[model samples]
Target: MRETLGAEDPSLEVTDLDAATAAPGDLSTLASPSLFGEPRLIRVGGVERLSEAFLNEALRYVESPADGATVVLRHAGGVRGKKLLDAVRGGAGGGIEVPCAEVKRDADRSAFASGEFRAAGRRVAPGALRVLVSAFQGDLAELASACQQLIADTTGDIRESTVQTYYAGRMETDAFAVADAALAGRAGEALVLLRHAIDSGADPVPIVAALAMKLRSMAKVLDAKGPAARIASEHGMAPWQIDRARRDAQGWETAGIGRAIVFAAETDERVKGAARDPEYAVERLVRFIAARGGAG
Candidate 1:
C-alpha cells in the first residue's frame, strides 16, 4: 500500500509514529503541510495502545483530514480504539480500513509466494514454487525474502534446482533430505542427516512433520488412478509431488506404507512432547522407515 502511494506521488513524505508514544501535538504538526507542500503520509502504528490524548486527536483529525496528507491508523483488532475505529468506519475523514490478516495455510502461503514473484514480473515454475514453499513453510517473512532474493539474484524462469541451490542448508530442506534418504532405504545416510539436523538446532517437531508429509503423500498416491495432474488437483497436491510419491512407492508394499504412516504419527506425537526422548524417537522412526524401504 505504501508502495502504491509512493508510485502515485513521487515526493511523498513518509512519517512513522507509534500511537502509544506520540505526543499531544505530534499528529497536528505532521498533518500540516510544509513550505514545499509535498504530499505527506503519516503511518501511526499500535493504535490499540493509543494514549488518551492521541485517541482524542485522532478522532477529530479523521473527521476533517488535512489536505495533501494521508494518515493511516493501524489498529490490531481490539476495543481499545473503538471510538476512532467506529468514526472512521462511519465515513469520517473518508478513511478506509485495510485488514492485514495472518497467513497460516499452505495454500495461502503458496499464493503469497506466487504473488511476490508475479509482482516482480518474474516467472517461477510450479515445481520451483513447491520447493520454495516447502523450504520455508513456517516462516512467511522468510519465504517472501527468499522469493525476492531469487527474483533479484537470478535471471529468467526459476526452477526446482534453483531453489535447492539457494536453500539446501535450510532446516526444512534438511528435514526433507532426511525423509528422502529414509524413503530410499538408506538408513545410515538418513541417520547421519537426522543427527546433523538435530545438532544444527532443528526442531524435532517440524522434522517429524516433514516425515509425516512425505509418508502421507505416498499413501495418497498409492492407489490413486488417472493422470498425475488430475490426481494432484483432486488431492490438492502438485503434479511433481504426485509423480515423486509414485516413484518413491515403487519398492513399497501397501501394508508397509500403512505401518510407516502410523509410526510417523507416533513419532510426531513424541517430538511434540509426548515422550521423554524426542531425538531418540526420531532416530527410531528413521531406521524403521528405512528398514521397510519406506513401505508403509
Candidate 2:
C-alpha cells in the first residue's frame, strides 16, 4: 500500500507514530493541514495497546479527518480501544478497514503466494507455488518476502525448477524431496537425502510428517476418477497434488498404496517416541515405500 501510494505521488510524505508512546495533540498536529499541503499518510501502529491520550485524541480525529491526509490506525485485533474501533467501523470516519488475518491453512497460503505473483503481473507454475508454500509452511512473512525477492530478481514465468534452484536444500523442501524420491522407488537417493537432512538438524518428526502427508495424498487419489482438477477439488487437494500422486502411483498396486499408508502411520508413531532408534525406523519406512510396500 505504501508503495502504491508512493508510486502515485513521489512527494507523498509518510509519518509513522506509535500509539503506545504518542503524546497528546501529536496526531492533530501532523494530521492538520500543512502549509505546503503535500499528500501525507499517517500510520499509527499498536492501536491495540494505545495510550489514554492517544485514544481520546484519535476518537475526535476520526470524526473529522484531515484533508489530503490518510490516517491508518492499525489495531491487531483486541479490545484495547473498543470505542475507537466502534467509531471507525460504524462509519464515523468513512474509513475502510483492511483485515490482516493470520494465514494458517495450506490453501490460504497458496492463494496468498499466487496473489502476490498476480499483483506483480507475474505467473508461477503450480508446482513452483506448491514447493514454495511447503518450503515456507508456517511463515507467511517469509513466504511473502520470498515471493517479492523472486519477482524482483528473476524474470519470465516461475517454474518448479526455479523454486528448487532457489530453495532446494532447505529442511522443509528436503523432507518433501525425500518423500518424492522414496515414493518414486528411488530408495537409495531418498535414504541419502534423509540422512543428510537429519545431519543438518532436521527433526525426525517433520520428516516423518512429510512422508505421512504424501502417503495420505497418494491414498486419497487411489480410486479417484475424472479430470485431475475436478478430482482434486472433490478430495480437497490441488491439481498438482493429484497429478503428482498419479505419477507416483505408477507401477504400484492398490494394496501397495494401502500398505505404504499403514507403514507411514507406524513410522509417524515411532518417530514421535515409540522407537528408540527413530532414524532407523524412518529409513525402514523409506525402504518400504520405495519397494512399493513389497519386500525390498
Q: What is the C-alpha lDDT of each candidate?
A: 0.84, 0.85
True-vs-predicted CA distance for residue 230, candidate 2, Å: 0.9
Candidate 1 lDDT over 1-296, as tens digits, reads 55687789888887878898999989999999999999899878788889999999898898788999999887866789989888988889788877778776556777788899987779999778877888997645568679978998999999989998999778788788898899888899999999998898888888888888888889889888889989877877667678888987878778888899899898888888899999999999998899763432
Give the residue spans of candidate 1 off by over 4 A: 1-88, 98-105, 139-142, 160-170, 293-296
TM-score of each: 0.69, 0.71
Q: Which candidate leads the pack in lDDT?
A: 2
What is the lDDT for 54 in model 1? 97
The TM-score obtained by model 1 is: 0.69
C-alpha RMSD between model 1 and the true structure: 5.3
Best by TM-score: 2
Instruction: Pull out the clashing pairs in model 1.
Output: 256-295, 256-296, 257-295, 257-296, 258-296, 260-296
Candidate 2 segments exceeding 4 Å error: 1-108
Query: RMSD (Cα, Å) of candidate 2?
Result: 5.4
